[model samples]
Target: MPVARVVVDVMLKPEILDPQGQAVSRALVRLGFDGISDVRQGKRFELEVEGPVDDDALGRIHKIAESFLANTVIEDFTVRVENGDAS
Candidate 1:
């Protein structure tokens, strides 16, 4: 069986407020990172698929991300497929 890897990145909508991100930004400023402006926190999920990875598989993964990994109402997600060896 062929193996593949998928990465899902989840992020909050632009209109949503991210207190954790803001706190990180403030901490950066206090640490003398003056060039920093804003910050947004997000999540990454890496999946190792044991079988062949094709368009159909990617589509399913996208659905899974939408249904389980992220809150569609306030967050958006991106999916990336990578060759198994790259991982």
Candidate 2:
């Protein structure tokens, strides 16, 4: 068995306004970064799973993501399983 890495990307729904993202976009323009029309901010979560990340583990992670990690009312999330260390 080996350790596997899982990634969870959480982002606000398109319909929702992202103030932080807007601020970042404004800052970029102030810093002379032009031609970029829009920007959105998101959250990323990494989990280290021992042994193999089987279907059960993935299912549990999905539940965790929906239950604890993301606010379903205004956000969406995706789960991905990756092999070995990311770095």
Candidate 3:
């Protein structure tokens, strides 16, 4: 059976503070990396499923991302479906 590959990116809301990102940005500056103004940390998730994925499956994945992967109150997420490769 063919498989579907899904990728989800979760990031903090604009108003939410990201201390880790800030620290990384500062470190970069200290290391002489210029032109770096701001940074925000995020998470990426890759999922593989057996069989072809449809709209219904996408909806279910979105629900899972919103409920289990991201904190909707302080974070937002985006889901992407890859075309051919499932690995």
Q: Cα lDDT of all candidates, in order?
A: 0.91, 0.93, 0.92
Candidate 1 stretches greater than 4 Å from native: 83-87
1-87 per-residue lDDT for model 3 (tens digits): 877789999999999999999999999999999998999999999899677688889899999999999999999999999777435
TM-score of each: 0.90, 0.92, 0.91
Badly placed stretches (over 4 Å) of model 2 are: 85-87
lDDT of 2 by residue, 1-87 (tens): 677899999999999999999999999999999998999999999988887789999999999999999999999999998656557
Clashing pairs in 1: none
* TM-score preference between candidates 1 and 2, better one: 2
Per the 3 Å backbone cut-off, how many clashing residue pairs does candidate 3 have? 0
Weakest 10 consecutive residues of candidate 1 by summed lDDT: 78-87
| lDDT, model 1, position 75 | 97
Candidate 3 vs. true structure, TM-score:
0.91
Candidate 3: the clashing residue pairs are: none
